[model samples]
Target: MKASRVASARSWLRTSNVPSDEYLEGIYYVQGRDFVDAGIVSSEIKKNLKEKGIPESIIRKVAVVTFEAEVNIISYAEQGTIQYYVEPGSITIEAKDIGIGIEDIELAQQEGYSTADDSIREMGFGAGMGLANIRKYSDEFEITSVPKEGTYLRSTIYVNGK
Candidate 1:
């Protein structure tokens, strides 16, 4: 976290009624709907990364990956949360949801392979590019899912542009 953001966050913590732990943990909730709040979620992450003085290239990649991951939860899960932490040389993003999980991780990562339905497809998304795009932008990626339990995705991008 940057000095400005840290100071702002501390001010928010003092004024806001939300828990301090959640703020410290950097968790953001997501709600799936006809059109989920994917942009809002992504922008928040971008704002934090920018405040930290992360490179623009890295910020852009993180924004894209974050949006895709959020949309996946919105399209497939009942609810989910995106958790992120900034370390000295890297930032980690973890998305967890409770909904129908992917049956095949490998297949899902294939470009142009999507399980999105017609409605979601109509929204200009679900082109089978979400996972592939995410992977393209992430330096490291990991996904885990079960039949009915849910899915979890973790991605890490190096801050030093490594």
Candidate 2:
């Protein structure tokens, strides 16, 4: 397979009619050196989603997916950004990170597979369930990755869920 390409999120923003950068409520730069700071970033996501009028139920689901995705950046990647956007009837969460791309997405998606060190596990993550949970909670999901470049995850949870 060819290396995944980078797709600017401009199209989605334009399609949603929300200014590409205007819709972004908050941005977080997560690094491996500080897990607490990264964890705190979760609240920013929640606040923005709430302000967007996303249903509490759906927001909870989005939170699960977002937190899991953000933790992946913290544990594996050097640093990354978590961007938030609001659309007509949904909240979008995008995680972009520069890290060693997953060589086998199929294997990485397995519920019990993990490459995290003991330090991560002791912190209450790295149970190898982040991706699985992300898959479980996100209503719409897409992941693109490049070996030496990075990984990008886009997910949406509708405000009025089906």
Query: Which window of 10 residues has the lowest lDDT sum in candidate 1?
Result: 13-22
Per-residue lDDT of 85 in model 1: 72
**What are the runs in model 1 whose C-alpha is more than 4 Å off?**
1-25, 34-36
lDDT of each residue in 4-35, candidate 2, tens digit only: 11122211111123334335455666664345
Count of residue pairs whose backbone atoms collide, per candidate? 0, 0
Residue 106 in model 2: lDDT:
80
User: Model 1 compared with the native: what TM-score?
Assistant: 0.81
lDDT (C-alpha) at residue 72 in model 1: 89
Poorly placed runs, candidate 2 (over 4 Å): 1-24, 51-53
Backbone clashes in model 1: 0
- Per residue, candidate 1 scores C-alpha lDDT tens digits across 52-159 of 566899789888988899888878987778877767677788999999899999999999998888767766789999999988889999999996889999999887
Q: Give model 2's TM-score versus the native structure.
A: 0.80
Error of 2 at 112 (Å): 0.8
